[model samples]
Target chain A: MPASASSIPDTVLVSADALHALAVRVLLRLGLSQAHAEAMARTIVAGQRDDCQSHGVYRLLTCAQTVRSGKVELQAEPVVAPTRGAVVRVDARRGFSPLAFERGLPALVEAARTQGLAALAIHQCFHFSALWPEIEALTAHGLAALALTPSHAWVAPAGGHRPVFGTNPIAFGWPRPGPYPFVFDFATSAIARGDLELHRRAGTPLPAGCGVDAQGRPSTDPLAVAQGAMLAFGGHKGSALAAMVELMAGALIGDWTSQESLEFDAGAQAAPCHGELVLAFDPARLAGGDPAAGQQSAERLFQAITDQGARLPSQRRYAARERSLQRGIAVPRALYEEIEALGG
Target chain B: MPASASSIPDTVLVSADALHALAVRVLLRLGLSQAHAEAMARTIVAGQRDDCQSHGVYRLLTCAQTVRSGKVELQAEPVVAPTRGAVVRVDARRGFSPLAFERGLPALVEAARTQGLAALAIHQCFHFSALWPEIEALTAHGLAALALTPSHAWVAPAGGHRPVFGTNPIAFGWPRPGPYPFVFDFATSAIARGDLELHRRAGTPLPAGCGVDAQGRPSTDPLAVAQGAMLAFGGHKGSALAAMVELMAGALIGDWTSQESLEFDAGAQAAPCHGELVLAFDPARLAGGDPAAGQQSAERLFQAITDQGARLPSQRRYAARERSLQRGIAVPRALYEEIEALGG
Candidate 1:
């Protein structure tokens, strides 16, 4: 057993390294190939490092159960192929979305070189966990990227009793002259089910209008929200956006929308394959051959905001990240114990 | 006077062709060259046909006034150039956004052929009018597109007393397998000024939570909404989206941002040029020669809606367009008289 596994539950000092390694081991035990296991582990671990516990290792146990139940494929490679221009299509073959993204990003990034802006849409893939990282990767390459995804389960259409829509998220990032990209990633829903779960666990009331009860009336109890449908952020507009994502990803990419009754055959456990679309543009394409000039232009704008005494969008999140990094990743004591007991 | 213009009293029953021609005549009368006048006319006509009355011929008077003041260069040509890949930049030179787009579209279309997607950002340009027409035009060529423009004069930042943001609008369209593309265009504001004006004219009550009074308290009076700052759609989220558009169009394009003083130059009714960003993509590339198939799959999922049997987002809009076309465009009596006055 790893030495760190012995020290798991007693203190609040879980090293990021230990978490990553453990996650990787768990993935391997769940039958992922070595490379894929490592990739999935890193993505989820990074999510936790960024304080996205809902998308992080906390979901790994569910993922494992899903895998054992034959829902998610642990060792499937994406079918990546080029079509026209800088566009590429990937059929995930019931594989993990992170794996699909890992395979597709290189091609999409390289395509941006010749196309100025490139796009990729993946169908038949499971959750990629977090959108920010995918967009952040493009930003690292000095590209402004936007990504959208549709879900296979867990949400309903607005004004409808049946679950027919996914939370459907949108992620966008613009490369800045600063150390980090200006990134915005959010679901069209008022709040994520994960957050509801967290509040339910903590016995906290949800913010008003976040969700509805099973009967579709406004409810503040997190547990009811978890069991019932989540409302779109605003009324019609938010629903329109979520519906747009459904059309863009599920419809445009040729995936099963959540509205279709779950097929319980060979493909039933074949990872509730969702749909994803990514668009990345190179800013240099418009900066008159002087990449530095575009950077300066963006910098000046940022300076204007700072000088005018306005805060950047992710400033608070960045601060939280810094604090967590300085200390260590936080985890519940019960969770750490459970992870230790599940060690293969 | 055109003979057909006489039959409609509190209205103008002009053909699309007739309207375009008259718009060109008006622009030329305001000192624009024949070609620039035609380009601007076509754009405005397109907006009218698309039902974007607010940005259509409704603004002709203001545009004429601006042109007379030499705030808008009547015959100025946009400086069109390429960026890295399929990116084009147009220095509008205080020209109309439509003219900027007209000069920029050919290159962008060409870029889309080889780049999968083309992105164009116009700096120092006047209002582009309704975004739907631009999107509609692109969709005519079987492309998916999105356009964003930051209006700097009419919206308030979240939790702020003064209007520091524009009703900054975001427009996105996708070519479905059906007759018309799915287009969604709306301002980040709770309600557009035109909608409020309509409410005021009809003596209708404004929707709650849509606007604030002079003292910054929420108000349901359309008049108050017009006089005071409009609320954002979904509180913090909508505010964030508006801020994003400002950053993308104004800051990224080196135009302007809300963080700067809203008052540009008094007596300068000529507002500083706004920034416009347009993105065009070919879904066929990402769909791998199967856009129709993908769209079909999406339709199945979307149509499974248990609410009203799965309706498309633009279904109502399309039906409205069809009805309008069949019954002739419905114009308010006051607006009809207003345009008739323009002719005189």
Candidate 2:
């Protein structure tokens, strides 16, 4: 792989196909269906290709453990039902989120095209994968999309000392008349939980306003924050956004809130079972019935932003994907060995 | 009047009705139709009732100045046209936004109720009022709503030196089966331009991360920030949100981006003529024709938030509204006098 600035000498470089095969093998061994396993593997490969290591093969071990522990059903078949008007619902049957999304997204997109807008409410799934893939899929089909989900609580509300919110994430994608769509996905917290975990492992200090210690005092020490609560990214504004996600993904979907998810986990090693809300909009219909006008508007917006020298969101991920395709994906030797052990 | 903690002897108290009458009179004197003037007055009154003084009567002086300067059209009628399927468009006819909204919102709500979701794109209007009032109106009709709008440039990109974004506010409202809907409206900037102006007038230092100095260094001096650029609320994440708003409200609505708005204004004292995009979702359709279930989910979400002692968004505004009803809206004597001068 083209070496990352932080890559060590002991890192293992594997072709993208090899990494996908490895993930599929391990998931199949855990009793996943052939189609389900392959879908899961593709998402893992996308994560690795995009340089989101936390959501890549590093999550395979937990997936195996969760399936073995019966927290995530191995052969569950998600059921998709058309709700009133253009809304659809997916009962994940406690399976992985990828399978549920696979079954629901096509219908959602069709509904949006027919009705101008549509919504998908997915529940009873473990959504540990990156959100960008799903939104990107919608944009690739010439549709605009927004997705929100609440995870287990790791963030504290503004002025609060305890964890009451998740690293609740919101993702949006807009289809333009170009090869790449405008996509952005981010957690509402100051940093992702995995990033904080890395800082703790390396014994590094975090930036100011990242988190608070057990006594609610601002702290740069990652270990202290791990033992306490992480702060929302932008004080009250971030807190408001986190709460909004909770309401949209949790309550609106009739699924567990972040606090409820924590209780459901009950100290388990598996990822939390969460809900996801995805919205798709057909800009062709919204742009006075002219699809070209909608695409032109999006192109104009991209030009305006780029002219200001502002980096488009997810631009780095696309760059990383190109490098990984040219060379390979770099993984720590230890992690690769660990995955190999799980496969057998 | 129930006194606010920050209220001083220089504050003048007026009944909400009287304030509304005064605003209507001032707009009518500036050549607005009676209906348009009354609609505009109601929005201004709502801002003061909700304790948002920055968007209340304090803006009347500038409103008059802009109208008298022939920037904001005084007697324009908005046109609402159904584009395709559930989407609708409003040509604001270069008039006030309140009139456009007044004419278009009912049709937008009806379209959403029929199609499960609808979008309203408003253009060629100057939008200067608080967004909460509009979104709250949607929730009042049992519809979930989201609104985004761009303004004059005052915020810089994450690492860029000069401003390329406006405050770029976002507002959301979730309908619940309760006395009030869950609502939130906030600027993507660390602090709003009006709030920064207040700090500058008071000769006070701003909080950390609020803005950058002319040299692109973080500064606590409000004066320096006023002369420089405001920072996005949470670095890159906030910057992405501001850009998203600009795309949706500016390019999508065929209006001006923040930079373009500045160029159009040409250093005028009047408010920038911006665009707005409002989305309405009918939960009755999304909840599988069972609106009660949607309401119940919202109620459960609110309960969970309140159980954690996390303040619900807009709770403060509701409390302020109650207090204003019991007593009166507190306005600075100078602002009241300035508005009175506009009436003559």
For residues A255-322, write the lDDT of model 2, one tens digit per residue: 76787788888878577787898988776655553556545655655665577576789888989888
DockQ of each: 0.41, 0.41
Candidate number with greatest TM-score: 2
TM-score to native of every candidate shown? 0.86, 0.92
Chain B vs. true chain B: TM-score per candidate = 0.85, 0.93
Name the DockQ score for candidate 2.
Answer: 0.41
Model 1 scores a C-alpha lDDT of 0.70
Residues forming the 10-long window of minimal summed lDDT in candidate 1 chain A: A1-10
lDDT tens digits by residue: candidate 2, B183-299: 999999999888898999999899899888888888999989977889988889999899888777766545667777777778775677877889888766655445565566556
TM-score of 2: 0.92
* Model 1 Cα lDDT, one tens digit per residue, A37-135: 777887877777676767677767867766776766678878888646767778887778888888888888888766667788886777757788898
Q: Return the clash pairs for model 2, or none.
A: none
TM-score of chain A of each: 0.86, 0.93
